[model samples]
Target: MGMSAGYELARRGFKTLLIDAFDPPHPNGSHHGEPRLIRHAYHGGEAYVRLALRADERWLELEAAAGEKLLERAGVLNMSDPDVYTFDGRLDDALKLGVRLEMLDVPEIVKRWPGVRLPDTYRAMYEPDAGYLYSERCVAAYKKLALKAGAELVTNTFVTDVKAENSIVSVRTKDDTFLAGHVVLSAGAWFKTLEPFIKLPIRAVRKSVAWFEPRGTLFDAGTFPGFTLGTKAGGYYGFPNIAGAGVKLGRHDTGVEWTPGEPFEPFGAYPEDEGYLRRTLETFLPDSAGKLLNGAACKYELTPDDNFIIDTHPHHSNVILAGGFSGHGFKFASVVGEIAADLIERRVSDQDLRLFSVARFAVAR
Candidate 1:
């Protein structure tokens, strides 16, 4: 988010300076994972769908600007029991938004992807245009663009303090202090570090994802599609094997609460890290449930309601806050950056950002 926002601000002729705790595209942050799903027929609501559509357009523009491929149109398959609200919500959004969605029965799902083994009662929604994004590459692209657009980047610097007063925004590091007319706080999991200035209820949760060796081409990207499955255990999402990267999988719910400054435990820290993914794969994608290639652990900055916080500080309107993405925010980075720049420059956005206001939460003060 910070990289994208920095790029937008710099390109738009703002004297922008981006500070990062570590060189981006590193494993420490949530954006390190190789693939992030991008679905337009959103289960969340119309607001998300609108933002997603705009984001899709922006990603293409970025790709053109960078002269590299950052998004893959591998398509996405959403599988769930008929009674699951997630499935209903996605279908409802598709119908109302005119998104191209194909409702698939168990037979069609099996016929289309022989590897996916769902129960007879399960249904599937296939979005042919939805796909996955190359997360690290997207960050790198934005970083390069930001620099080319004349933005100064300070990497591997920890921001110790942030203050907004008298229409001036002050950001301090251990070595130096800088002041500007406005500040965009996009600290990700470390967002709580600024709680003293911008009070909000947020926490960092440790989550794990893994890649499994597939049995054959059945789960390859050309044949299979990116998928989300709802089962008795929980919601699981995955990407098909792309360029022999293996089948990537992760659980969408339930992660350990982690402190902001502590070392994040690796993927095998808990038995369920691999165990749960293995079980989920065995049940839904039996063919792709081969040996485990590798795993990674990242953080999710979650709000109480799992919605994003994209509003300015309650008292300090110049300090824009963008975090608490929960787990599903990577695809929106492009538009979020635009919105951040919009708020900073115009103090308003054409997009309806009321859904992500800081006022929605009972702030901690």
Candidate 2:
């Protein structure tokens, strides 16, 4: 998101300087895995659905600008307990926005991809315009575009503090002090450490993604689709095999409370996580659970309500806080980037950012 914003700002002739603690496309942050789901029948709200649609448009714009493919068109199948209240507003938003979707019973879903079996009462929402985004590739693309647009790219430089005084924004790094009319804080997990003086409502939690060898062609790209399943027990999501590698699965909840300095070990390094993945795969998709492959961990900077915090600093108007994001924020990077640039350039946001404001936390300045 930081790079996307920088690219947009530079494209609009803003003298933008993007700083990062580590060079991107590294395995230290949240968006490191192979693919992330992009769906229009969203679980957040109508405003998020609108943002996702705009993001989809921006993704196409990037593909055209970069002259290559980034998003794949594999449909997403959302299987959940029909009685759960999670999809209540989601259904209304999808219908109101005219997002193309279909309702399928357990039998129909199993018939579509016979590797997975489900209870007779479960329901599915199949979104046709949904698929996966090659995550790290996306970062590389935005970095290229930003550099091409004349944005100063500074990697391997860590930010120490960001303070604003007398309507002037100053960013202090380890060895340098830089000034700007506006500063954006896109440091993912390190944002907590950078602004420890302010009591923000963000927590850095570690999550895992597991992979499994496919038993047969039923779970391959040709027949199967990317899937999300939820029950009273828990929920799991997975993608089809990429280049004959293997299928990928991830649980939506945070595993262990993570700090910034800890190592990002492979997921199965802990026996409990491996056991959890095994049980989840054995119960959900028995046929697809052929062999237990490897897994890895990542970070999610969570907000109190799982929405984003895209508002300006409560004490300083020249600083913007683009944190929280939940775990599903990667798909909206393009639109959020545009929003960041809009906030920095126009002094007002183009999108309604009330749901993701820092005022919800009510912190003491």
What's model 2's TM-score? 0.96
Candidate 1 residue pairs that clash = none
> What is the alpha-carbon lDDT of model 2 when measured against the actual structure?
0.82
TM-score of each: 0.98, 0.96
**How displaced is residue 204 in candidate 2, in Å?**
0.6
TM-score, predicted candidate 1 vs. hidden true structure: 0.98
Go through the candidates in order and give each one's C-alpha lDDT. 0.90, 0.82
- lDDT measured at residue 213 in model 2 versus the true structure, 0 to 100: 86
What tens-digit string does per-residue lDDT give for candidate 2 at 1-365? 89889999999999989998889877888888788989888877888888888999999999889888899989999998877534668878988988898888888887887777777888888988889888888989999999999999888888888777787787888899999988888777666777553557688888888778878787787577788988776777889877776788888765777777776666766786667766777887876676767677888888778898888878787787788775789999999899988888888876778888788886624
Error of 2 at 141 (Å): 0.2
Model 1 ranges with Cα > 4 A deviation: none
Say which candidate scores most in lDDT: 1
